[model samples]
Target chain A: MKILAAVSRSTVARVLNCIQVLVPKPHVAVVSLDEEAALASKAMGVEFIGGPLPEKIYAIDEFKEYDVGIAALDNDSINISVVKALRSIGIPLVISLLNNSANRDLLVKEGADYVIDIDSYVSQNIAASLSMDKWVYVKPLSIVNLTLAVVRLARRSILGVKLGELKSALRSKSIHLMAIDRLGKVISDDSVELNAGDIILLTGIESEVYEASMDVEKLFRRHEETLARSFAESLRASTRPYG
Target chain B: MVFALKSRGKVSLIIYLATEKGVRNVKHIYKSIEDSISVVDTYIVYYGLGAFKQLMDIPAFHSEPPYCRGKAILSGVNLVTSPVIVVINGDTSCFSIDSISNAVAKVLSGETLLHLSKPQTNTDFTNVYRSFLQDILGELGITQSMLYPSYSIIVGLRKFFTTTPYSMWSIEQLAAINLREEALVVENNSCIDSTIDYVKGFEKTFVKDLARKAVEIALQRNTISRNRAEEYLKRIEAA
Candidate 1:
């Protein structure tokens, strides 16, 4: 496949370099005047077009030959323009990296096949890794407008809970406990008990998966509070003298 | 930031941050600017664009990089009704109130329309670069006041900005060249007192980044620096 990457910042170049490293078959070409981007392209061995991106970007002859175009510029406006430009010239697939999430809808409106909310994805991953006891990988099923989240079962709130009990709880909130990945075995049976390190698959309508995740984390916090209160009462009773 | 005495003229402060991921400092910078909002007509600060779009309560223009710097300056100056502006680096550099007010006072007065204050660092590389540039501009018949290193503060009117369109050249060099008669340069204790080192060289692309600025300006102005500037740039490259 002929892939053209519109590079501006070092971050985009770094990502494109990774793609080149892992899958070396595609003929990737990068067009940019940014010195950092140029250096990255040179090191990665992608065909580099070194010059200012002309105002009439669609008029460039080399762009017409590509099957896919990636607009990974730093600016949202430029990225939006590149998406439109690539579509105008009849490229089959156009992917764009969104700098600001505010422009997410705008990229979709203008001919971008896939809009990666790059900034949002990065920050969310960092925050999730820091706050959550067990990591969850979530992806949207665009056709159904549903969300699929694969959550690792590690929190004390649901460590020994039966799969049937957990399913009924999630079902009360319109979520499905799809499957379990426990020790390389797929468990669709709900009678099985939940283990500490089992990976639980969840599917729910658009925003419900996120809500369920938060609800699970909240349960952990609530458990800690009640445990603390009960422990304090026990301590008081133990210290009291027999009257 | 500027103050108009007659009928409460408008003043705008454009804080262009240099480094990235300095979101923590925005609140401190914003609070300080807010205190002066009563005195100065209007001011807006944003860290390298994207981070401040939703973070700050005040009205700010949030943008990503790759903007034409000349057009960016003009667009900012035009936003506020006032043509005067103060350009400062928010992320890496901070200035004393005394020096900031001094720069504003110099611009407000008839003494100079373009006032530039540079940060004083312990290193001598700045001094060396300043002298070398001074001699080069001198040879080109561009008379200037005792020019300092990179500009940390800029207080200038629309005329000064229009005269030297701030293209690829540093604002300090442009201000010195265009506002020669009405320009003032000062060195205040700057980067050393800053939270981090104020300035650093272009690491990966120094040769291209450095050569382009001087060469582009020389070519546009049709100056004699076109032929001889390469020799000086080579020396800079070697160093």
Candidate 2:
């Protein structure tokens, strides 16, 4: 497919890199004011349009034949203007790189088919990685306004408790223990005992699931705290004060 | 940067963590953000009984038994004394200091509210939520194509959040208020509400960077305190 890529400054490299991976032997047309970008585009064997974007794009007659257009400029206002112009000119698919989060919805409203904020996307992925243990899988049950999350019950306090006993608490948090995995075995039965290392699948809304997970952690901590306190008390009672 | 902000003396950030799962996620999130940017006060506003006695010294609020989204937010808001408050979901990944700094900049620059968007997933639930939100906004005379706020990261003036009514519909209400104020919308969406998402996120370059950065920043801030950030970094390294 013929592609029109509009870039400004350092973003040219990132945009070009992405395009290279997306299409083998890509016939992309690059537009930018950066001389280095023009040189880079020439090196990549893509058509180069060296000038200011959005306005420069409208001047190119060959742009009409392009199936997709990408506005990956660093400036939000320029990106928005260029994407708006691209959309107005009937580019079937237009994507814009959003540098600022605040401009995301504004660009979307401007008719860009897909708006990506690279920073947010990357950071979100990073954030998700940091907290992987809380929820294994989260599928939104659209019809029920609930999300299904596969959670590992890592807290020892909640171990050995029957699912039936935790039912009321889970229910109060809007969570349902749909299934449990105990040492490679999946148990759908409610009466099975919960173990410290068992994987428990839960379903609830985002808020509900969050609360449920917190409750589970609390149980584990409470168990540990009590054990620690009792052990400390026994040691104190068995020994005399040296002071 | 949380500590940096505190040291600067010109500004301060109060981070409100909304949780129902107790301290497991909160502890990790707190240290990650602290490591990534040691410039803020992190508060744990929870619905659970108590597992966070260590944070007892830190100002906190307890939501009434049986969690409610609205109450948690409102309770956190009531406790916030900073000019700006960042209300983050406990389950979502903690944002880097730069992200929070950017949000504060927008807040200071006349924007009334800033809502961070999550990456859009083509899930049945997202479609449903989008359609519902679009229809509701349409009826309210708001443009359907306008930005919709994700509940993951919300930053605004202290009074704005504290004064708003707390309920399950608070997010919607916050969006509506944003519409009236012409709020800033940033896209920084990451919610691991499921195993699938968590796995996908773990496999990404940024997620790995997050763990690494957490360690680097933690070590830079305080080598003596082997906090959760260190623990998480070790786990990531081992994995």
What is the DockQ of the complex in model 2?
0.02
For model 1, name the residue pairs that clash.
none
Quote the positional error of residue A2 for candidate 2 in Å: 81
lDDT of 1 by residue, A51-151 (tens): 64423355578778899888887766557657867888888998888886656665776688887777666665665445434645444433355665665
lDDT of 2 by residue, A106-161 (tens): 57766788777664555544544444346544433223445555555555424365
Count of backbone collisions within predicted model 1: 0
Error of 2 at A84 (Å): 52
| Winning model by TM-score | 1
- Residue range B1-239, candidate 2, lDDT tens digits: 45544444332233333344434456665655555433345455554433334443444444542234455565555434456666766655535446665665566555546545443444444443353344333434444433332345666666555434344323324433334435646554553333223223223332333234434433444532467555656655564
lDDT of each: 0.58, 0.57
Candidate 2 segments whose C-alpha is farther than 4 A from its true place: A1-243, B1-22, B32-41, B48-57, B119-128, B139-149, B172-181, B190-239
Q: What is the Cα-based lDDT of residue B132 in candidate 1?
A: 52
